[model samples]
Target: MVSIAIIGRPNVGKSTLFNRLVGKRLALVDDQPGVTRDRRPGEGRLMDLSFEIVDTAGLENAHSESLSGRMREQTEEAIRIADLSLFMVDVKSGITPEDQDFAEVARRAGGKIVLVANKAEARDSDIGYLDAYALGLGDPVAISAEHGEGMGDLRDALVEALGIEVFDRDAVASDEAIVDVPVPEDDDTPLPYDETKPLRMAIVGRPNAGKSTLVNRMLGEERMLTGPEAGITRDSISVEWEWRGRHFKIFDTAGLRRKARVQEKLEKLSVADALRALKFAEVVVIVLDVTIPFERQDLTIVDLIAREGRAPVIAFNKWDIAEDRQELAKELREKTERLLPQVRGIRTVMISGETGEGLDRLMKAVVDTHRTWNSRVTTAKLNQWLERTIAHHPPPAVSGRRVTIKFMTQVKTRPPTFMLSTTRPEAIGASYSRYIINGLRDSFDLKGVPIRLGLRKPRNPYAAKKKRSS
Candidate 1:
């Protein structure tokens, strides 16, 4: 695929243009200068053309060891690797000294450059558009990345610069490649498992918890840069691989510290990126150091996974170093239950990231948890179980009248959510709800996944008649 890099001075709408092409908010965008410190790469689409697009930090002159200098290095590396560079300048701001300097640098980089005069929608930008010719990068493609104006001209320019055939204008405008599948006639029948859709899983934990190491072990290669230093990973990077003929997409996320300690701007962005991965994932593996496993931060991460409704599997890393394995396992189980009662019976596995021991068992646990997370129960079976459960231990009374559960149905699954209709639904307290949830978990074998039970008041048949009379 053709790789393109968006290179420009600070706040010229380069990141905005990158987001526009990628069709998603993959990079952080803000009004402030230098919001993007790292070079982020994503798949981009322009009309019918598909390619890889990289968003780089704004170019600036700084000391080699300074933060801005590191950003400059990252930008230069991106430019060096890209087949084409989109040298952007804020036409509204006109041609500045910084723009002139970077223009020369981009010219020396020796790649096909297409000058983009962003924010050209304004009438005042006419002079700046003419001034862009002084950079000697050919005719500038006037555009407004924010408002999405002049995209057709930009597409034409890219096609010309890349030396590709003219794209069919009528082709569908989709950011990703799509494959057609036959639709099922029956709505009740679940779709078959799609091996093409990669199972997305995220490995997350506190700093120095061997997240990167575990990723390397799983891939059977040192794909991730690992070290003894803490916070080595600054962004959530995803790697695609296959395990046992099943395609998988795993994300290795930045180690999260407590909110009070995370004061740095870049660290905050990294944490936000990790959370995006967590929400995107189908299953989350919380990797913990066996020696210091049950930290408050670990519990906090587990709570986050549960609240996000993603299936979770706890992996005690570095288990090979422990002395009393059996005793430690018993203590771990007890602590997990006591600490995370919200998600009881979550699957846990002990593994060594260094030696690759117990990885098979860990994968088994992950696959099982994912299956249970997606498991659904039919309404007939659900109502039957609900009836039997309520008969065994009926809902207690609040004040003078007793609460009555009329009917129940399974709404959906993927960490199953259910709806219950009852008389005076608000009368059911949290303890009773817990009892019903526990009953559902035990009866349907829906263990090791989060379950959501919502209550609804019974419909009033006479309310409509009363409204009609009024």
Candidate 2:
């Protein structure tokens, strides 16, 4: 539903309206004019209507400045993509010559326009509303963005223009997925894997980290290329092996750089291949050199695991040449705490992928993290925790009314996502959100995996409980 664009001359609350609609501060807004430089896209939901929203830079007279030319191009592209336009005007200042020029340009696009007179809070809006009628776009809606007034008129305008019907989220409390995490039922023993079906594993790290030798050691034969130079293994090559009674498939991938410095041809293609393999994997093992483990690029890879919502276990390989294993291990924990803060409590195991030392711990950690990633909490316990949490702090009241958060549950679990239907999602502080996540980690032992808390509109104005099916 991403067909709406907020366009104006300058500083008429276009960015403010974007932030309010997006429910997140994605675009920067300032008192200064022309703060937005290009078209920015974001996800927004107006009640039940979830759609894409584009906030664009203020239009200006055709000029030769490099930045202006780029902005104009971006603005034109937004107009072409838009299904409907929200033509904004400053009610306080009325229409200027620049506004008239911009109106003509917007009309040339030949899309439906809904005039919006912003800053209509304290003062009258008849002058700006009257001027907008002359533009021949249609009837204009007056709004006060700061006070959140006249949103119903805007909603009605959108409904009439977009031909959309208003709807509400279903309030059914889902109970089916709480069925215990599935294990090998009846056949506790993992039967022998079919010859054609290979158990795959992907080993990824920074450059010159001995990824090639590790694969050679595991295979006991030089099936893949080994070199001292960085990026010798450009393609994701898979190798099959049998460990104990379990079969295995390992994918060796090219290293990822610091994102900005990734300007090479072969490296980019190689990285893209690795990302695809990661997406297809059931388990992902991120290998890092002991000397410089979890660098910014390494964190980027680890964060990619959480972003992709995969089960991850980190292996600090090449431990044979390390100065002191004890001290290095302590330093690694500190670095994980300081740097990769999002996925806290991730299992960090030390291993020599070359010499096969500590490989047992690496395998065990992967199985453990996978189980936790598929975890789900029971309704009784979840409600109990929610009760205790709300009793302790209580959702902070706004405008002299204390809001209530009645029910909650784990909606889905790849990385364990939860949803809390509340009176106002905006009032939940970041610290409190972290508190709930930390409590779940500590109480439920859900360590080292990402936990997502999604806030949704309350079902009833009185009590907005949360639940889900999938």
Candidate 3:
């Protein structure tokens, strides 16, 4: 695949230009001088051309010990590996010496160049177009990357500079025939996707977080319809799909409600569906909107996932137009940790069904997390993990008798169900059960998913001795 790099000086709208080109905000953007430091690579399709685009760290002349200086080194390395380059300049700011220096670096690299003048919406690059000639990078293409002004010229320039082929303009258009995503095959099915296996996933969140959008995205095509018209999806619909060569029969559940106000029949059914889905799913994807990343409904979903003994993976959707994404992601992570401390390490993925952005990351995380859910500890290894866990913080005493959990064995794969044989299962409090499940979820990296441990009271240990004495 063709590799394109957008290299320019800091605050030159390089990231804004890159986001416009690749149709993804993979590179973090800010009004500050230097917000992005990582070389964020993203995959995209431009008309018929499929390419890997690298949004590199902006070029800078800061001191060697400074972060910006290290970023400059990374940007230069990315340019050296690129097949083509898009040199961006802020039309409003004019050309800084940094721009000239980076232009020379790109020039020395000898890669195909398409110089772009961003923020041309005001005067249409009046001064910037004239200043472009001094950079010695040929005619600069003028466009507003933020407002999407002059995209036609930008597209033409990309085609000319990168030799991008022109396909049938209607290639991906769905006005005629609908496009369907491939289904997961049976052999590729993990423990959660098999026909007999209940694929437990919880559709949860506060009111109107697009839990429905997630269900529809997974179902796709005909025979199923879902949307955001408050409680439209009344009942849990069990739909099946083949994801990446594995078979998954999933339940498109209803929007969950809080425990107090769940007096309505519909709300009760919806909550029940969500609870059932969590029990059935080998892996669950919690739906959360980027606008409201984590709310009370989100916390309730996590609690339900923990209660039902299922695996969960958070879907932070609607990232297409998220503002303050860096802060949003940070807040989202912290909120999930604080709210659902039981599953502190549950995986969270930022995605957008509207733009199909970050779907691959979501799928990969789902698959990887599923593996952890299906993970089994050998009788020896489990006892080892169990022994160490108990020794570190032993079970508390209840009614003057210290509860002794003798052994634990994983009896099931889906949801990783385990059996913990103890002296008195009835005496085991809810808080202590969580202690073990939480320990398993964390120690085993079974984050964001449910792990169930059934507590069965050990047969009366002294019964045989007392009977013999009688």
Compose the digit string of candidate 1's lDDT tens values, residues 169-271. 3433442312223222222244454545568899999999999889989989755656677886766767778988888888888999999999988789889
Error of 1 at 389 (Å): 1.6
Off by over 4 Å in 3: 1-207, 215-228, 259-280, 394-405, 421-436, 454-462
Per-residue accuracy of model 2 over 146-227 as CA lDDT, tens digit each? 6677888887888798777432223322212123244322323323324343345677778777776677677675545555
* Root-mean-square deviation of Cα positions for candidate 1 versus the true structure, in angstroms: 5.8
Location of the lowest summed lDDT over 10 successive residues in candidate 3: 173-182
Candidates 1 and 3 compared: the better one by lDDT is 1
Model 3 agreement with the true structure over 299-383: per-residue lDDT tens digits: 7677777676566788888888998889888988887777777666888889876666777798778777767766655566678
**What's model 3's lDDT at 450?**
65
Residue 180 shift from truth in candidate 1, angstroms: 22
Q: What TM-score fits each model?
A: 0.73, 0.54, 0.50
Regions of candidate 2 where Cα sits further than 4 Å from its true position: 1-200, 461-470
Per-model C-alpha RMSD? 5.8, 19.4, 19.0
